[model samples]
Target: MTAHLPVLQVVIPLMAAAVCAALRPARVAWAFAVLVSWTVFVIAVLLLREVLAGGTISYEIGGWAAPWGIEYRIDVVNAFVLLIVSTVGAVVLPYAGDSVEREIRRDQIPLFYTAFLLCLTGLLGITITGDVFNVFVFLEISSLSTYTLVAMGRERGALTAAFRYLVMGSVGATFIVIGIGLLYSVTGTLNMVDLGLRLSELTATRTVPVAFAFLTVGISLKLALFPLHLWLPNAYAYAPSAATAFIAATATKVAVYMLLRFFFTVFGATFSFDTMQLGFVLLPLALVAIFSMSLVAIFQVNVKRMLAYSSLAQIGYITLGISIGTVTGLTAGILHLFNHAMMKAALFMALGCVIYRVGSIRIEAFHGLGKRMPLTMAAFVVAGLSLVGVPLTVGFISKWYLILAVLEQGWWPVAALVLFTSLMALVYIWRVVEAAYFHPSPTDEVAAAVREAPLSLLIPTWILVVVNVYFGVDATLTVEVAGRAAEALLGVPR
Candidate 1:
């Protein structure tokens, strides 16, 4: 059973998703989805424990050895990612029951749960697989389901957003496939570990750089880093709030993980950093993404859209850490991956509760929410404070590491820019706060009628907010895990 945990993490969700699609009753589908997600979460926790205590676990699918057959490799890096993805699904599934019932059509509920489970499966498969081609397969699985899930939004624009994402996402996936094909032609193996070994032998080849270019562009699109992020705001804005919260929390984080896996694991530091000089290219782009997107987020009228752009800016922080390419820098990047997941998930879930009550997520809709829905507004405030990098919030821990990483490279100017961006975050967060608390309600009826969100949504949403503060105050687990994961990626002793 222990040896089979790798396959179980993904298989349970994949199989359960099919069952959900076939389930006649929507309630049953929800129950199955929640069960599957909880099981995956447990498997992920066990996998992490094994990796931390015993080191990497390499499970050859069907008992075939790696390089010849598909492999599911569990290591500290992917184990942490697995935990993040599965944990989000576990939380979101229960929350989905209430949120989906309100926003999605009753007849469509089963399909929504099916798509959600499929997305969960794909993310876990991408994290667990050791085969390069399998990554593309799992990526498409997630991307396809994500499009369906996004389009299920009651908003008419949801279809358009899903279409746009499908087009852009398809192009990104194609580039990744082309890059993988090029690597396969050069190295003659689809297994990432074997490819890594062979790739070192072709350091001087032109195809190597071409493959790198294709991969970097492809992953940047998937992760929605800066200029390539046009598909993100609308997708988040139009999707059902539950879909927005789950995808916002996990999707791009998984893409960022893929980038780290390929850049550090497959290509190696020497080729990626020294030969290709990725830092020169990525550092500038990341900086642009941080400042430019934050500026754009401040001007948005829709609160959900504003938070979507803020999500893009946060991705810039993760990318910037990778661009630095040192152990401390990588640690910062990886840690932010986890921290931002908690903060953004909590924020979006809070917005979902607002949408449930007011049937909208516009800044105008939140005119007097603080007085009516104090607990919900408080959750938003806590998450917003974390976004602004307030002390004792997960956001502060991420920024602290980012600043330390920047200083490690003697780039005081860049460090200052990071601080400046935090102030920008504060400005945008303040906008929401002012609207929620200070502004008068649009009407007396709205002020009189508004109440707190149902307990189902509030519980999951606040659990994440509580986690944001809890983890912020106690960073031992996150720091230790991320630090070791960073060392492993850098080929240094933990």
Candidate 2:
């Protein structure tokens, strides 16, 4: 049963999605979706525990041996990602019921849940699968469902955003597939571990670099990294609040994991760094993303769009850690991957609650929110502080390590730049805080009617808020696990 955890995590959601589409009643479909999401979350937790306790678990599909049969490989890196993706699904699905009902038509709710389940399954499958081709299949599964989910938004521009994302996402997927084909042509194996072993032998070949270029560009686009992030703000802004929260938290994080896996595990560190010099190329881009996006975030009139830009800046910090390419740096990068997920999810969910009651996420709409919806506004404040890297918050832990990583390289200027970006984060966050607490309500009627969001939304949002602080205060679990995961990727002996 334990050995089958990987398959169950993905299969449960995939099967539930099909069943959801067939189910007539929206309530029944939602219940089934919730059950499947929770099941996957449990499986992910179990998988993580097993990996931490006993190291990697490689399960061959259909009981066939690897190098021929497909593999579901579980290690610290992907197990952690599995936990992140599934946990987001588990938390968001419950809140989604209320939020989606308000935003999407009654008749569309069932289909919305179906697409949500399929997207969840795809993300989990992408993290768990060790077969290269399986990643592309799952990627498409998630992308298609995401398009449908985004298109279901009540806003008129949602269809346009969804269509634009569909076009960009499809092109990115094609690049990834072509890269995989190039790799397979040279190595003749689709299993990640096997490819890792064979890729080093062909490092001098021109095809290796070509494949790497394709993969880097493709994954960067998917992850919404800096210059390639044009599609993200519109996507997050126009989508339904629930869809925005879910995708903001999970989708790009999974793509980052895939990028880390391919660069560190499949390509191997020596080929990626020493021979190809990927670190030099990525480092500058990450820095530019950190500063430029934060500036853009400060100017956005819509709160959701502001957070979307902030999300891109946060991705920069994660990428910066990866570009450092050392054990400490990689640990920082991986830990940020988890921390950012929690913080962003909490922040977006808080905005979702605001949108639920106020029917808008504009910055001005937040005026006097503290007096009207104190609890919901308080949740937003806490998450905002976390985003600013306040002490005893998960965001601070990530930034601390990122700075330490730069210092380790004796790059004082780079370290200072990181601090500068944090100050920019502080400025934008303060803008929202001032609007929520200090400014008077635009209209007294809105102030009179506003109350805390329903418990359904508040609970999940606060759970993530509490986690942001809890993990910050006690960094042992994240630090240790990420350290081990980093060491493994760096080829250090256990």
Candidate 3:
């Protein structure tokens, strides 16, 4: 059973998704999803522990051997990622009950959880699989489920947003599958490890470089990297609050993991950074995303869209760290990956609370909310401060490492820009804060009627809020794990 933990991580949620779809009562399905998510998270924790103590764990399907039989591989890098995905899924599932009940049609609630579980299964599958082709399969599964989830938004525009995402997502999938096909054509192996080993012998081939380009762009689309991130704001803004929180936290992070796996592990860091000079492309994009998106976020009236744009900027921080192309840089990227998950999830969930009580997320909707929904608004403020990278918050931890990483590279100019964007984050966050705390609550009935969000919603929001601070103040554990994961990816000795 212990040996099968890698497979079980993906399997349990997948099987339960079918059962969830068949369940008659939406509340029952929610309860079942909560159970399945917690179980998957426990499996993820056990897998991470096993990898930390014993190193990488690999399991073959039906007793078949690797390169022939499909394999699920868990190492420090992906093990940590699996933990991120499952942890967010577990935390967000419990929150989904109240948020979903309010946002989605009552009859559609069961299907929402069903899609959520399938999305979870796909994300875990993408992270755990060792076969390159299997990544594409799981990517599609998650993508399809995500489109359905996005369309479940209460607004009519959700259908348009979902359709746009579907078209863009399909194009990204096509590029990824084409890249996978190109690699298979040259290497005659779909297993990632075998492909890596074989590709080392064929570096002079034109096919590999083309495949790399295809995969990079494809993944950039999926991860919502700057210029390619146009679909994300609308999708996130219009999606059901539960769906927005879950997908915003986990989906892009998983896509970043895929980019790392392909670039560092499959192609090798030297080939990716030295031969191709991938950092040249990534650095410029990262900088633009940070500065441009941060500016865009400050102007947003719709709070959800504001945070969605902020997510693009946060992705910039992650990619910026990766662009430095050093062990410290990679660690910073991985740390931000984890840290941003907590920050953004908590922020979105707070907005979920706002939307639940007020039925609106416009900045004006938050006027005097600090007094009306004190706990929920307070949670938002703390999480907002984290997003601004204040001292003693997870966001600050991520930036501290990023600053160190850039300084280590003697890229002082880049380091300064990072600081500048931190201010940008502050401005955008302050917009909401000022509205909530400083302005007067509208005299309208809805504004007057708004009260503190229910405990059911507040509990989940605060759980992530506490996590944002807990991990920030005592980051020794996350730093150690992220450092180890980065070293492992770069083949640096412990």
Candidate 4:
């Protein structure tokens, strides 16, 4: 069982997703999804522990050898991502029961859970697979399911958002497949390890560099990095709250994982940074995304859309860390990948709670909500504080490392901009806070009607809230894991 954990980690949720659709009563499907998510989460924990205790774990399909048969590989980097994705799924699925009931029709509920599980499976598969082509396969699975999930949103705009995402996503997928195909053309192998060894030897080929460019652009689009991120805000803004929370937390993170995997592992860090100079290209774009998107988030009427824009800015921070092209910088990027997932998921879940009661995530919908939905709003504030990089929160820990990484490079101006962007996060978050706490409700009837979100919703939201703080206060475990993952990717001695 332990030996097969890598395959099992992906197979369970995928097979269960099909079973979920056939289950009677949408609630049963929801319960089954939750069960499968927890199971996957436990498996991820086991996998992470296995990696930490030993080292890399590789499973060959049907006992076939590498570079011939498909392989599922687990290491500190992907194991950390698996933990993040599964952890979010476990927490989000539980919250889905009530939130979905409120937002989706009863008949559509099972379908929603099915799509969620499929998306989860795709993300996990993408993270664990060792084959480059398999990455494209899983990317499609997740992308197709995500489109379905987004289209299930209550608003008509959800369809438009889904369509836009599909168009952009398909183009990105095409580029990725072409990239993979080109690499195979040159190297004659799909296995990442085999490709890496082969690619290191093959030099001065125009094909490899072109393939690298395609993969970079494709991945940048998929990860919603800066200018390529137009699809994200609307997709996140109009999707079902549960979908938004899950997708926001996991999808782009996995895509970024693809970036790290390809740039650092498959291509080798020296070739990617020293030869290709990816850091120079990524650095300016990341800075633009952080400052520009943060400013955009401040003026939004719809809080969900505001947060959606904020996500682009947050992604900028992750890419910034990557662009610094140092082990500490890479560690900060990866660390922020996990931290932002928690903070943003919590914020979106809180919005789900608001939508549960008020049917709106517009800023005005939160008027006087501090009194009406005290716990939910408080959770929002804390998560918002975490987003702002306040001390004793996961957001702070991510920023602390990022700043340290920037300063380590003596990029003083870049470090100051990072700090300035935190203030921008604060300004946007404070806008919501002022409305919720200081302003009066439009009507007493409205105030009377709105009450706290149910415990089912509050529990998961607060679980993440507690995570944001707990990890912030004591970051020993996360930092250690991130550090290990970074060192492994950089081929440094642990």
Candidate 2 or 1, higher lDDT: 1
Write one digit per residue (lDDT tens) for candidate 1, span 1-494: 88899999999999999889999788899998888899999999999999999999999999899899999988999999999998888988888888998899999999999999999999999999999899999999999999999999998999999999999999999999999999988999999888888998775788989999999999899999878999999999999888899999999999999998999889998889999999999999999999999999999999999999999999999999999999999999999999999999999999999988888888888888988888999999999999989999999999999999999989999999999999999999999899899987777675568799999999999999999999999999998899898999889974
Q: Write the per-residue lDDT of candidate 2 for residues 345-434, one digit (tens) a residue.
A: 999999999988988989888888888888898888888888889999999999899989989999999899989988998999889889
Model 2: worst 10 consecutive residues (lDDT sum): 442-451
* Weakest lDDT window of 10 consecutive positions for candidate 1: 441-450
Scored by CA lDDT, what does every candidate get? 0.93, 0.91, 0.94, 0.95
TM-score of model 4 (CA atoms) = 0.99
**Model 4 poorest ten-residue lDDT run:** 440-449
Candidate 3 to truth, TM: 0.99
Candidates arranged by lDDT, highest first: 4, 3, 1, 2
Backbone steric clashes in candidate 1, count: 0
Candidate 3 clash figure, as a count: 0
Among residues 3 or more apart in sequence or in different chains, the pairs in candidate 4 whose N, CA or C atoms overlap within 3 Å are none
TM-score of each: 0.99, 0.98, 0.99, 0.99
Off by over 4 Å in 3: none
TM-score of 1: 0.99
